[model samples]
Target: MDLASYAELAIELVNSSDPAEDSLRDLDSLQRLLRIRPHLGGRVTRRDLDAMRELRDSLRAVFTAAARGDHADAVDRLNTLLIQHPVQPQLSGHDGQCWHLHLTESGSVPDRYAAGAAMGLAVLISDRGVDRLGVCAAEGCGNVFFDTTVDRSRRHCSPQCAGRSNGIP
Candidate 1:
């Protein structure tokens, strides 16, 4: 399931767009994100940017549902994404590395991102538990995150948010 790899992709995608501001405001921003994660690289377009924004919202809903203790809703939302994206598992050693699982798809950049992110979240929820998905608990920050803490006590999306919430800076 290459959980960390794919799950981080999902988290990055969701975090790129937040209630306060959207990092993916143009084709250039979207391309930059894809450059950061070459697995989802492609010739992006305006349509792709629009689609990615939509995908961000959909993925955020899954985290929101999980945070609310609505497992059924979270599962349902993820299921819809899986059906829409339909990722195919494959093994690839793309950079002269050992063979590892990779979720591949044939479509636009947004489509590929959607497939990988949806499949990753689905596997993560089933293997670790839905509670592993979460929304930032810091006030005014709606970024979503995949909790990796041993105690599952993650409350903010990042250390900066945590510090701000604690009045540490």
Candidate 2:
């Protein structure tokens, strides 16, 4: 996925309540997890999609730390990543794409994607609060999620994830 789309998806994937479910099985699952709000006719790939999964795992760490209300740990993790894989934003796409910056080079692996997403979340937490990260309260599923809700009371990634985790019949 493109950088913008990756950013959008990062928000949703980190906030999803069911990381182990079918929603995460498709190529677009990464986009969905990051909440990219896919467009029709968009091409997706799973052959080289390992980066997306890596993104998921890395995000899981951040969300898990956030869920526990440990801002220090989350920040430290993100910072370590930044130090290890520093990136500078530059414009390269021919489409102009608003001339936005990217945290990693083109064709980056999942690690780059994960680092970028974590960096974004870290910024959000530093500016907003650690309460933005959350987890499903359902019985079996302990998936991590991002709370973009204005009220900050979101409890699950989706109704289905919530119901399944809660043992609702």
Candidate 3:
């Protein structure tokens, strides 16, 4: 899988829940997330769901710190997670695609997921700077985002949020 796509796993996990509601509220929700991220699949259970929730909170803090200009805190958080959930890198290719780097398919479902997400975030921060990580500016919509804009002016998580913030709907 693409490393950047793995970074998206981190963003998705952080956005999965907020003060208003939680998408990963049950095993089915967790399964749904896994379905989208086929690279991170295993025999998940309720325990894994709880673990993922905890990981989500941890990742959110990282993004929050980065988006707020606390680069040290963000790096520290990613480092801690990297240490906690080490990933083994390997080259893989299938479906007639070119060979690329991928994290090992070992460990429990949560661990594997955490490893990829944390590693992806770490790589992104190191490569593009922590400012690329941001939280949505839309009111009451605090979803995190990996800003890929040329000018780095992305403020909202999605165009829908931007429109909603601008009263377009």
The residue-by-residue lDDT of candidate 2 on 121-148, one tens digit each, is 6566666677787777776666666677
Q: Write the per-residue lDDT of candidate 3 for residues 9-95, one digit (tens) a residue.
A: 899899988656576888887888888777777778888988999999999999899888998999999999999999988888888
Off by over 4 Å in 3: 18-21
Higher-TM-score candidate among 2 and 3? Answer: 3
Candidate 1 per-residue lDDT over residues 4-53, each given as its tens digit? 46877789988887645567988887777889776777798888888888
Choose the strongest candidate by TM-score.
3
Candidate 2 error regions (>4 Å): 1-58, 106-108, 163-169
Q: Which stretches of candidate 1 lie over 4 Å from their true place?
A: 18-21
TM-score of each: 0.91, 0.62, 0.92
Candidate 3 is scored at a TM of 0.92
Top candidate by lDDT? 3
Ranking by TM-score: 3, 1, 2
Error of 3 at 141 (Å): 0.7
Q: lDDT (CA) for every model shown?
A: 0.83, 0.60, 0.88
